[model samples]
Target: MTLAFDSAGLGPGFADPVFDSQSVFRSVLNAVAYPGAIERLAHRPGAPEGLDPAMASVVLTLCDLDTPIWSDAALSSEAVSTYLRFHCGAPLVAAAADARFGLIGDAAAMPRLDAFAMGDERYPDRSTTLVVTVPSLTEGPQRQWSGPGILRRRTVAVAGLPDWFWADWALNQGLYPLGVDVLFACGDAVMGLPRGITVKE
Candidate 1:
């Protein structure tokens, strides 16, 4: 049997799998807990063709064999697919509804948040977690956010999102505990937008 390690355009994975993942995991947690605060990723994993370094680190930290991922056309290249399979052991799914995690290469072209797997009332934790690649986290239209993890209202800006993204997020917020969570990546930083967060544009 010939074992192939040909990853189309995929680059190297984590330099220190265990420690790097642990560090990335902490950043992810801080992002989620602080909602709009930008958390800089300490790990610099090799990113695939269409993915950014921050998003790639997030996938490596959170995805695994148990997670099913959905990616947009720009991010669905063989390089990204093979990279995820080899490093994270995550399976790729065609439909967003079936994915535990969704990777969006172009935030402006991303599907509606409702298109993803919104967990049921019984198990709201089963909803999908979206990892969207954006141009910049600190350079865009500012929005005020208030939610569970936030101490008070926080103003933050995220570039490269569609014009209707705020509107769509408003609708998603109405879904309460049954909606999908999102993490926006820019360069080596990430910002979380959990379902509990409410955004005012």
Candidate 2:
């Protein structure tokens, strides 16, 4: 789909749109290809004040008019809404369950994983992809992660999450091919936590 162009409504995105988006898209692919492995984000979009750099880059690279977005309390500011609308032309949804992409800035208060779209049994790929911004990538409880993307098993620690997050992850993972996937962003780095990944605490 063609991205809606706005000359005056939103802040500018990539300087070199095609090349820059390709670069960021590569990073996003790598993140999902190697779950729990941090991929350095590329591009420097003129993101809104509260939007995280990595999440913003990912949104610009992956989102379009077809995707609907949901923003958490910390990221639902008017500036962010206007920016995303103008740059991405994506519909902003009020309910988390309806969003194809959820931008979360407050991990502690974000909705549970099950609250978002889990897709249908037949079209499991229709699930939501959460892009959550946290404080650190390596300063939380360590858990052993293993799945399609992992070589054998990888130990990962993510900071700035609520205590119940892992419990939600466990349940989400139990859904096998039908569940929500997550992209954890810290600073300018992103790490994937696909539904296939098993986390052993």
- Top candidate (TM-score): 1
| Tens-digit lDDT string for candidate 1 (1-201) | 999866556678999999999999999999998999999988889977688899999999999999999999888777778888889899899999999999999898999888998899999989999999999998899999998888789999899999889998898899997899999998899999998899996
Angstrom error of the Cα, residue 127, model 1: value is 0.7
* Model 1 spans > 4 angstroms off: 2-4, 7-9
- Scanning candidate 1 in windows of ten residues, the lowest lDDT window is 4-13
lDDT values, one for every candidate: 0.91, 0.89
Query: Clash number for model 2?
Result: 0
Q: Assess candidate 2 and give its lDDT.
A: 0.89
In model 2, what are the clashing residue pairs, if there are any?
none
Candidate 2 least-lDDT 10 residues: 4-13
Model 2 earns a TM-score of: 0.93
**What lDDT does candidate 2 reach at residue 162?**
90
